[model samples]
Target chain A: MTDLYESQRAMRAMRRAAIQRGVVAILDVGTSKVACLILRFDGTEHVLAGDGIGAMAGQTKFRVIGAATTRSRGVELGESCAIQETERAIRTAVQAAQKMANVRVDHVIACLSGGQPRSYGLAGTVLVDGDVVREHDVARALASCEVPDIGPGREVLHAQPVNFALDHRSGLIDPRGQIGQRLACDMHMLTADTAVLENLIYCLKRCDLELAGLASSAYVSGMSALVEDEQELGAACIDMGGGTTGLSIFIKKHMIYADAVRLGGDHVTQDISKGLQVSMSVAERIKTFHGGVVATGMDDRDLIEVGGETGDWEHDRRTVSRAELIGIMRPRVEEILEEVRARLDAAGFEYLPSQQIVLTGGASQIPGLDGLAPKILGQGVRIGRPLRVQGLPQATTGAAFASAVGLCLFAAHPQDEWWDFEMPIDHGAARSFKRAVRWFRDNW
Target chain B: MRPMKDPAPSRMAYRMNRLMLTPRFRLFLRYGLPVLLIVAGVSIWASDEARRDALAERVAELRRQVEERPEFMVRMMVVETGSPEIEAEVRDILPVDFPVSSFDLELDTLREAVEEIDAVASASVQIRGGGVLAVTVVERVPVAVWRRATGLVLVDAEGHRVQPLDARADRLDLPLILGAGAGAEVAEALEIIEAAAPVTERFRALRRMGERRWDVLLDRDQIIMLPEDDAVTAMKRVMALDHAQDLLARDIVAIDFRNPRRPVLRLSDAAMQENLTTRTRVYEAVVE
Candidate 1:
């Protein structure tokens, strides 16, 4: 048991440093495309030792050695519609990224956009041996946290003890060996369906990369795009992608909550394709060129020619007003934003600082998106771009790739994971555990 | 009718008496033979080869475990740093003096054999690394320097022997335990000592005496003895009290607050010796 715990601890620590060693790949399965990037970090000293304190300044950084994007195949919306189709797409991206980077990455950190995730806060306490609470005592207290019954067929994705205190004193970061009768800890845990997680892991195994770690797309996107101040002061990053819009909240430089809405840019594209009697490709072109929610005075004369393949030239082309285009796009955009607004409210956005909301994603690049955001998402809105990372190509930095880019940042600096904190092999429910230990000494 | 014979009865009468005298004897005669035969048959079958093999496997596993090393994994890390070479000041301790497979013993008994070595924290000769024997030594992470009347000695909080002070305080943040024989709790005492590392720049020494108590000597002439049952707990309470109220800044000689709930203060000898003062009780907890 102790050996298992240590190995788990080592695996968690290896993730960030391993990615920077110039051998990391990302697997993103979305409805529109199966995107993959093999980031080969190139620099002097790939791993930073002792609290990222290198005075070399900007001399060290990662460069995108390879990249690939394949059309969404065998995937319905964000989740897998069929396993074999998804695997094929992943293989294409992996091969492309590998061919470009000139290396084979055998480890991948995958990100998922859709899952029913709920946030729960738990606190646990353990009595110190005598009155001096040591580091082991605090760890024992955290292990005492009752892993919630997140329902069957679901596995815990993240279990992190964020805060700790000894006795009456709080905010003791590493209370390993201080004396106190009571040591307390606050922990956060995230769970996802075992089937969903297993499917992703299975797909990656086929790609020949070990599943190193997993993160929610919304969570990584929030980390990559939100600035230090935005993260510290509190802000919401809503990533409007091809198949889904990911939402996350950041505070204290950590992503506290993450969620997603199934509706995305594809839905709007479909509305236009069906409304304009055009193919998805043509609808996308028109949406990119003149898609707007709020039609102004200049939009009325927008004479767009509709063409057909038939030989009758007069019947083949018809003049369409810009207002009609706006009419077709506005409702779908509103529906997506409304779904996101509900998720924000559910996440308790009112409690966070600044509460500044930033919208980014493939659809977020639409012309009238900035105007449409405030009406549904409230005030303090802006378009966000991922910043402070190296080795990213300009083609990959768009709002649509927020999750993939944010994944690079996550790969660079992961937060304190579950294995970092020391816990006894058989950490149990605190109250009964204390009672049982004390009882055994007395009875046996 | 058999009693009519008085002193003794005939064999036929005796047999009849045995059957009638005890309720259990009659009951056994009715049910015992079948049960005894069944038990004897089952016992005969149970001591068979299949059962014997299972027991043999269990015994073998237990014996294997008994021979396994009891030391921590770090001690067996292949001695990655040091090298074996012949220099002018020469040492052949690696292959000859302690031949490749010469020593085979655990660390508990060997600690005392090398206690006099100033540079050695603790060492053990072990038979490992593929038939090659090597000395396993744990260097002390020094926390403080302790001075005594007889001599200057280097000791860990647990009372294990260590190297003398090197004046490199910036490199190591450890607390010193003075007096003597603190080795038992020294391993655990390091935890308390390290907790004060961030707060206290350098601890003077933690002195042990009376075989039951402790005193942490900080800067100047201050001495602090810990509680008996939970010394680490008492030290933490003291640290907390000191951090919150600055208890250490005040001029003091000895503190006898072994009881965390009841703190007793003793004035420092510097002023007491000069003015010829007596002991005084300052803060006392009222018993319920």
Candidate 2:
């Protein structure tokens, strides 16, 4: 296990990088804000070693030096929708943090909220011509997934042969040299739309930064939000952001599924805007200041001044009871939870051993969200904060910036890079964008 | 006085010089000279002993170093001899405590232990601490046995010796080639259940004659006769054939490709299986 931790590719240079100056950076791109953290990775060598992360604890030795956040431009939900705006936001946050650290980086790994993502479970079998089942047999079984022909312009993001079964036997790890007549494999394949990734790459390129990596926001959020036990037992992280709500499921310490919904906190603000006949700015302010699901007994007499700039003096200072604010926010939060629940149920969540639900991201901090969440999501529900990284500042360590902080962790300690599919030929020969066209196609 | 001193010695000077030659002066030289010599001698002896001890310790240290130096060097040598380019590759994965693959080859200690298993031509073992080991091989005179696609196995004399190396092409001495399941009977071989051993300085290969008789091929490409019925006659026939035929004289092609009776001999491919008449064929036919 200790050896595996060092050899895992994501922490590639982390241990070595930790030895010198102990500095690393994390950048989180969201619809509402772009945040960057410059961590001074110190006191981590021994601490990381204590965690049994030997050898490469060499890389986790910096302290949290500085952090910066800027209002997001054209990024909606998670995916970069507009180049100039997203680039500007990324540059602003990065420059601010770099100025604080007085250092610059040439590479950055950006994460987006959504893409036309799909998951497929595939199984394969090999007739063991030789008496011993070996590494070659495993390779052959994984290779037998067929091209999948996800079409041109799209690429396979992750392909893992998650399970193996020897002849007549099932669920084996490493059948090598075992006298098996046949070998079988089960794989999980994740693919995303090519254009969505291209836009992210382009935005980073505009900042003159190489796209070192790209992650699904939901996956990283799940990594930060889910505890060890919950991750092992099975849990879902529903990251509620301004533009979209990201959902991810973890089992056996690996993310088995990830997805996003376009409906998020912005929708709630819009709902409040239309219902109260107020502008978006007023609606957001009210949502943050007066929002609550469970009204206390004293809330009946509480009054909030609803202001308008119209000429009528009475209309300018209209008063509304605090109960009315709860009435507006409760249904929207419930709707998001309901949609998440439906998605989880469809994914066979009941089969999982643990059904713990964690709500994170900026929108999850809505008061009384935890009390209302369990009723809609399931038995276990909780608000989650990003595990405070070694060198993170107090300002960046909030539940609202969980996605961004988690993004920092993602950049700091990415899980193993996947198969790195060196495809023989481009799947692009097939019809590109046809499947997802119905999504943006109907809207456009 | 600007003048030189007188050459004559005074009486007073002579008297003082005599006092110096008295017993006290004589005794001082005797004791001090001898004592100094003894002390110097002992000091030299002690230094020599310390140097000798230091030298012995160095030799022991060298011996230990010699023992350790070979483990890694030998392992790397095996990898290099097997694959010329493997030196770089082996070094890259250095300090590996385990062999990359263990089963295909193991140092053949137990298998080579049997006295009758002379078929093992040569063997060597190189172990890298990473558990990556290289076992180098040179197979023995496989008289005959089965060869398969999976790997070649060897069979030795006594008609019973069974080993996978018998079929290895590199061990050209083995001629009794058969496929899988064909070598079952030979696996039951005894050292001499078949016959008294031939005096075999020039013996090269042996073939199973129809699984019933045996043929021996000599180094000079001569085939010697062996009888199926009597072990003694086969021996006598083989010895006589060596003497009478002047077997080593001609560059013989085959003693006989077949029809071993009378052991009809041939010199060329054109003469293959020629001169084919003899009483109840004695048995063995071996060609180099």
Candidate 3:
């Protein structure tokens, strides 16, 4: 546990040094596309470390100087399946972006969508040793939370404090300098498969780039897609990508739940290819240009030519009605939405103050999805695009680039994590367990 | 009948347990509070002027502590390639105190200051071992002495003023130039003086005429008018003629070489009257 804390602190220090040097790269390794964006920090102001609550603090400090994307290979379901192919693809994207920006970057902050994330909420309280609450008391309260056995192959990605309480008063954002007998804390922890993380680190090492930071794509996408009010209240951002559908729940401007379904837009494309007997590339083209979820009577008359390149004349050309194309796409999209709804239900998302569900990503571009989403995923459903960032090219300002833009925001103003604090280490193991139990008792 | 009691507390306990197990609540306290505290602290620090000033002062104090370490102290400064007077002038111009921290010294600014001195042509400053701030300067050498109305000023090859001389004999090795714009034409004058080395003992001064051409003055009230375009070659031709014909010893007042194709000589008044008498006597003899 201390090893993890130490490494996290070291990584934060490295990130600060990189930012001070005035350039950092943001890499988004997704299922369908791998994108690299080089950001140049003008170094006008020193970004205060550990300041996580302010959203617009570092907004104008950085600008995208270079952006490049290439078709992802050897990656399936948002995880790298072939090391060498993914390395080659990453090199191509990074080199192209560096050439465009005319700057070489050695530090990178990467985001990924796989690893089967699990969310856990833990609470703890500590009796105030002083008349007024202080930072150490808050740290003690956080440390008193019960550490669950997240299993051997999993690692914690994000552990953030979402709520606080002082004595009888609950939902206190900050209890410091306030008179309270006991201080309580509610923390949210997200863990992912360790193997996936190790693979990513190894790949970065092979590419000769330092891994300064890492974030869950689902969490960052919610950060970019959801409005400020939506995040403050409660909302869920479902990012429909090529091979994975990432889901993240945000409340009080913090991600409380994150999960990914192994099915995404590529499944729909495969359905089209099998249904119309067309090549995968041609199916993708048809899906992007003519696909829709909700069909109308007018769609029946619209015919799309499904061309083939086989030597046979009969197989070279074929035609399908737009309605039939919709028929092939609607079911798969519905399945993805259903899976997302199930995951949200499991997370008890409906109990939150707001239930706004935002659908964003490449697959969310299907026509009529906004009309059909609420029917399957319940009310208050909307299609979302990534928030606009300064200096982003016209091609990258779309729903598909949510994670990339969010990564930029995350890199500029990262939320404080567990390792950022100085944990108390004087207590013996047995006494610490007892203190944990007692703190839990007082909070309950 | 006993099972009809409200299960509200139990239900609340179950909900609390489930909430505690979720990722959101755990992350909120663990990561979010520090962020909030830091933001609050930073905003407070930034907004409060007095506190910000105090923080800046503390940072500056810490930086000074590091900079004033023994290894970084400049114990002495050494000046190279200058006379004692020039070295003293350089030291006065440089803005550094002895035993000062090297980081506090701006080397480029110091170099510029040293170059601003009248005698310094170029200066280079570097920090060498043994706590030495070594400054190497190349001082300009005076090539000619210009006799201006105010005083005699020493001028370098590029016609830059080096210093003022109390007397012309103080720098007898340098050639003397006269007139208002003579300092700007020092290079050409020096070249002409070198070409007239044979007659240099008889040469007195070279004056700039109308800021275009030169009038070479000799010891015996004789003047050589030189053309502007090929003044060096013309001076060389005059020197060759003087060497062959002892032109300075002849009864001539001026040698005009403004037009290289036509060289003219103006004889003295006595010499001209003697020539007229001799010509009249020859005409009378021819008539008889």
The candidate with the higher TM-score, 1 or 2, is 1
User: After superposing candidate 3, which stretches have Cα over 4 Å from the reference?
Assistant: A43-60, A427-444, B1-288
Segments in model 1 whose C-alpha atoms lie over 4 Å from true places: A1-21, A41-61, A129-135, A168-181, A306-316, A428-444, B1-288
lDDT of 2 by residue, A1-444 (tens): 123222333334432343343545567788788887776555543444433213344454345566888878787656678887777777777667766775555456566776656666777777764689755566667656554667776655555565668878875544667788878887776667778777877776766555545667778888888889988889999999888888888887767777677768888888888878888778888888987887887777889887876667887688778888888878888888888888888878778888888999889989888889988887788999888776577887777677666666665554533232222121345325644654576588
lDDT ranking, best first = 3, 1, 2
**In candidate 2 chain A, what residue range of length 10 has the lowest lDDT sum?**
A417-426
Q: Model 1 over residues B20-86: C-alpha lDDT tens digits? A: 4345665686689678888999788767989778878999888656544343122321332132221
Alpha-carbon RMSD, candidate 1: 41.7
Report chain B TM per candidate: 0.43, 0.30, 0.83
Tens-digit per-residue lDDT, A169-237, candidate 1: 986655665777788888776666667767877776755567767887878888877888998888999
Q: What is the lDDT of residue B124 in candidate 1?
A: 63
Instruction: State the lDDT of candidate 2 residue by residue for B145-183, as single tens digits.
Output: 455556666555443444555325666544444434435
Residues A133-163, candidate 3, lDDT per residue (tens digit)? 8777877888888989999999888888878
lDDT of 2: 0.63
User: Per-candidate TM-score, first chain only?
Assistant: 0.85, 0.80, 0.92
